[model samples]
Target chain A: MDKKRIEIKNEADIVLARQAGRKMAQSLGFGPADQTRLATAISELTRNVIQYAQQGIFEICDQSNRKAIIIRVMVEDFGPGIADLDKAMEYGFSTSQSLGVGLPAAKKLVHKFSIKSKPGHTKVTMVMTRKRV
Target chain B: MKIPILQLKNLLLTSIQVELTDRDAIDFQYDVVHKVAETGAEGLVIDITAMDVVDSFIARALNETARMARLVGAEVVICGMQPTVALTLVEMGRELIDVESALNLDHGFEKAQRLISAKKRMPG
Candidate 1:
């Protein structure tokens, strides 16, 4: 499979990330519900890159087993890292005027979630699995 | 670039049948607020069953539209969020707590009716 990846530096980049993620999810046999979940998660993360860091890379990879294929998304940005990762993950916590549902809510959209950050770097990863059906 | 807004009785309905860009969402918000004023509609229902996803920007615009509608004495109901879209929005931390939403268009119409009646009963 061709590695699904895109650079997110603007509103258009965020759209591309969602489309690429959706295509990868579709190829991995993800159901429409799961596909939408992955795409929305990608949208949320790429939006963070544009809103916070101003630029970033969004990459999609696949891991497979005999019965299932896992689609993984990674978003990395060199923006202002979260001062409090834990706080950021809490629902209803926004440093901006937003509804504060971006980071913490994205965690629930996938089977797995992880984030790491320091002053100029932030990285988030999410994964969903599609069992052959 | 104008998203159609339909007026029925005392209610207004808008169904976004196309993929929306940031510009679309922005223009939609602007249009919705003004339409509510122009029509003096008491209820607004936004049907999004055809939409599979709403990004953060769109989410914000929707929330703003809801608030603006309320400010103009109109109650807004968002209806027909697909199961997947609902799940994703909740997971994304956008519960849209401030806006009233329904499971489908029919339910949305019911909710709009209720909200309008409730407002009429409110002491001014």
Candidate 2:
């Protein structure tokens, strides 16, 4: 696993983090669709950081093989975290005026996605692979 | 809700004044793009200044609107993006380049007029 990490503090950092992750995933030969998915997933997570946490850390690891590249991203933030994980995961549940599709959309964009959050901190992990489904 | 079609000289401006929420993002994209194409406008300016926040979906829709507009010889300019809204959009890595932006409706109209004039100057 080739691991790279970055900390996101502002909205600008989120853009950089997502671009970095997408570039790394592409360099490792992830398919275009997967690359776009990874980019979108990272975008969603980083948007959360800016909107909710105001700061977060993003980590990307690459797992390469003959079949495809497996990319994993982890975003962590310390802020007023989620009180109800289930409710937050719902499609139309938004604390802000947003469509509340960030988490759900991110989950759909990746092969696997998970979230762990408390009152003061939240962590989201998403994984994407080039292996054909 | 119906999308209002505003004709301005050679350009056609369509206003979809729906809530810029995630649930409406896809519909907004479809309606706006369809109307822009149907009107055969030389350029399109999406006025989202009425919206408070633009999420990933809306941002994506803007990008798509630009792409779709371009396909029909029309350019799309997104105007009235709030600072915070712009920040969120930038963080989301959505491409706004395809759609030119203005600070407000007046500014967008000015830019659009200039662009239309520029196109007119160019030989077909």
User: TM-score, chain B only, every model?
Assistant: 0.94, 0.78
> Could you say which candidate leads in TM-score?
1
User: Candidate 2: what's its TM-score on chain B?
Assistant: 0.78
Q: In model 1, what are the clashing residue pairs, if there are any?
A: A101-B92, A101-B93, A105-B91
**DockQ of structure 1:** 0.58
Please list all clashing residue pairs in model 2, or write none if there are none.
A99-B22
- How many residue pairs of model 2 clash at the backbone? 1
Q: Please identify model 2 stretches exceeding 4 Å from their true place.
A: A64-68, B1-9, B12-124
Model 2, B35-54: lDDT tens digits are 66777777777787665445
Model 2 C-alpha lDDT per residue in residues A17-61, reported as the tens digit of each score: 767876887787775555656776787788788888888899998
lDDT for each residue of candidate 1 in A17-80, tens digit (9 for 90 to 100): 8888888888877888888988888888888888889999999888776898988789999998
C-alpha lDDT values of all predictions: 0.85, 0.72
Going through the candidates in order, their DockQ values are 0.58, 0.08
